[model samples]
Target: MQIQDLPYPDPGVPDARSGPRFLVWLGRNQLGGQLKALVWGLLHFLSVSALPFCVGFAVQAVVDRSGARLALAGGLLALCGFGIALGDTMLHRAAVTNWITAAARVQQLLARRTALLGSALTRRVAAGEIVAVSTGDVEKIGWFVEAVSRFTAAAVTVVLVCVALVVYQPALGVVVAVGLPVLALSVLPLLPRATRRADFQREKAGRATELASDTVAGLRVLRGIGGEELFLDRYRRASQEVRHAAVRSARMWALIHAIQVFLPGLLLIVVVWQGVHLAREGRITVGEMVTVYSAVMILTYPLRHFTEIAMAYSFSRPSARRAARVLSLERATDGEGSREALVPTGDLYDPATGLLAPEGRLTAVVCGDPDAAGELAERLGGHTAESSELPSALVGGVPLDELPLDFARRAVLVQDKDPVLLSGTLRELLDVPSSGDVSPAEALSAAQCGDVLDALVQGSLDADDPMDARITERGRSLSGGQRQRLALARSLVTAPGVLVLDEPTSAVDSHTEARIADGIRSLRQGRTTVVFTSSPLLLDHADRVVLVHEGEVAAVGVHRELLHSDVRYRAVVTRETDDEAAEQELNQLQELEEIEETA
Candidate 1:
């Protein structure tokens, strides 16, 4: 539970029942740390609560003119001061430990969930929401967790002090006791309103954050489209809405603070007024009156904790709820399969769509709808959206989902249409868990990335070593085709038993696409390769081309056979009429001859 022992071996699955329940679960999970915080908090609050008694005793000693009593009072005061200093220091240490540990536990859980869900996480939850939950929301949850122990200790101190007062002076104690509960409970009615406003503010803030993230991610695209002003205005308006919602939330909380301050002030007034009358009428001594006044003033500190704890709970509840929602998202393959590893070396067959990529064959899937193609590509790698009800993809007569996740991943690598290249040196980017069959040079060559490497290293200090050149975030500094090729190169280096590529060369030129198509076929000569593409150059290179129409296989043949036989296939792959197709074919032939003659 200590900071040094962070990243718990088992950050255990969180209870995703509800917000309040999740918070309770967090407290339960860290019982040992919480107990330490509670003990220190109790000691700290007890020392604070003893200050009034020490002063009251000292006042009585002075009135009695007893040197022995005065000395005893001074000793008690010194002890209380020492306890306050030591207890406060230790309490702060324990509370901070609790906060850090709680936050770390939450972060670990989030990271595990993110890793499990992978790209599907962003599909299920906003990237901004994930960012918010991992950052600000986690801190808020930890703050509430850390505050609970202190709040409990403060409550205990308040009760113990009130009981001691009742024993010391029943009449004034009754007045103080009655007023204390009223002070604590006075703001309860306003809490619902404050919580509602706070939730609204959080909602608005999340939207604003999402908008900002989206805007920044697409800034380059926005500038290209000349839509920067439009997005900027949209973000500005979203930010303004967040500000307005926050102001509304603050107003409600301000009212609650006013009530917290006002009620305590009223209680202090009542205790002072009642004590003065009792002292003047000889019902209580001067020292007793001073004691009652001091007790009421000291009680205010603990009373403020009541409102603070409420505020903490209100903010953390929604944050916890969001975190729980993310944690609750179970992967489609989760809990439905065994942990047995399988080295799949057979065709990847999707029973739902009846699309099969035969083993050791370069199969091209041409789909009329790009969305359907993407889904099929995911299916080829045992990845399905959370909403998908499709049956498990099978390989070697074994369900891919039934295999251990690591085994399944190692067996089939799916490079999505929009693959991400993380910020790192080129060598680090290609350094993935692999079968060690393909070298960096071989993979890069198969991916047709020679031009990309040259571009990256052209003006760099490490010009001779392109692999050492740094890549910016998402490879944003690279061209679209360069990024795609780099992603393809990284995937090729893994050298999985099966590789599913979705539009691997869509961003590249026809000549480069032709080279990549040929290189891929040569590199993956004895492995299963499924390429979802409609490009003629890529389709022509496939050993077998399957035409997918309306989510089902419409035809299966070589690219040329399908073009001549299937009208839908031709429409999809060529995207031209009869005359246009003939004219394009003639132009390509003439261009090839001219290139051959010049060479």
Candidate 2:
């Protein structure tokens, strides 16, 4: 396959996608609104153009000694002001709308990509990176998009002003026209450094955001370990780094701003100086000179904005690059799994680990590496990948990639260890995205969540519609086990053809874990289920067990059989037992001893 056809490597590069390409992609989605905004911006710019011409006309009228010159000049000024106001309003409204909508659309598109990648996004991307792109970078991209119209309008305004001056009087106009280019172009020399400074500022901001998210997600654990202060200090250090970066960035911007103001003022001096020379030489009328001076003074408004837009883009470019990388993230697809309604009345095979679950049976996965187990679980659920011809992993004899995405999702569901439980009622939390046809009672029974529901009723949700009871955000109030069972119960309610659960019973007591294992097995009867775990209580319920070793399947049999046959599985499962506590430090040595004994 050609290189362009390949997915982007996880390069950790800034502005992940090329700038021109990203704009083209965005344009396809927003060109219409952008065009409309541009049209309005031009009209507004034209309205302002009347400023220079009217001044010149008023001067000529006064000089010619026609009708009440002052009154006519007042009327012209009012008319030009009215046009300016009308154009300004339209320009402002259109530009702002274009920016907000463009940002929102990009937000929606990025969110969709995140959903498509699901948990995989967190796996491949850092939490800080995602947080930065979604919150800060998105607004910048929108700002840049909106800035396009303003930039165009400013250019047109410059042209109109120059042309008017030249038309009124050629020699005077020539100097003004040529002089304005020099003023506008002066900022160009300083832009690169300014852009670089803005980019540095953005990078610091993203790092700060990343550090904050990490701290929050792990705050509880930090508190437990008494490392809160240590982490706080680390965050302080990170904050300091960001502060330094920000200061450096601000210095560059400060210089740019100073230059922006200073250059235009200098340009004004040049125009005024040349105007006086021409007026004294009798090459241009005094009135003409006054009008020219007035027009040149006004040029600062658009010129200032032009430089600012460039400044905003420079600061925003890094963010856009970050956003592009996220938007471009591809959902790894599994090549296996049936696309059609997975009746799933047959065996589930994972060639990657060589684990096969006979149709209508319970199978347990025992792995040395938790991550490997999780990856296997994802594959078994029919998510796709690029590394394999069979895609990432297969389900029900179909490549997950080949299966229509929705069908694959429904056919096989992977319940992660730490499931995200959005705030909602006990019932609402259990039923995600509207679990309409399924009764809450049935799901509760399947999940063994009656106690959880009862407890919430005793709390602030202590009202009618207890099932519709409000949950604290992220289910923070719920115990770890409750959350796990709730997640499992929800998965059970979905009743996917193949259920791949990663450490579903990890948080519960042994007694509870045992019950959950049985409940899951009974509820999933006549369906395929793969449980990634080495807990003896859960393992005992499996019809068969497969041990994943170094990313591949090493041994397969009944759990009891593997306990005797697989030393690694035994070491992992029993390593946490109370009986093994005394030998915990020596477990590695003990495992080696056991292997030697077996040999």
Best by TM-score: 1
* Residues 1-599 of candidate 1: C-alpha lDDT, one tens digit per residue: 78998779999979998888899999999888878878888887888888887888889889998889889989988998898888889889999999999999999999998888777788789888998899989999999999988898889988988898999999998888778888888888899998888888888888888888877777778889999999889888998998998999899989888887887788878888888888889999877888888888888887788888988998998999999999888878854358565577888898988888899999999998998888888887888776888888888778888877777888788999999899988999999999899999999998899988988898467547999888888888888999999999999989899999999999999999999998999999999999999999999899999998998889999999989767779888877787876776677689889999999
lDDT string for model 2 (313-364, tens) is: 7866787788777877775563242345443345778776667877778888
Name the 10 consecutive residues with the lowest summed lDDT in model 1: 334-343
Please count the clashing residue pairs in each candidate, in the order shown. 0, 18
Tell me the lDDT of model 1 at 389. Answer: 85
Error of 1 at 433 (Å): 0.9
lDDT of 2: 0.73
Q: Give candidate 2 regions above 4 Å deviation.
A: 1-16, 59-65, 68-72, 334-345, 384-392, 433-438, 458-464, 550-555, 561-569, 576-599
TM-score of each: 0.94, 0.87
**Each prediction's Cα lDDT score?**
0.87, 0.73
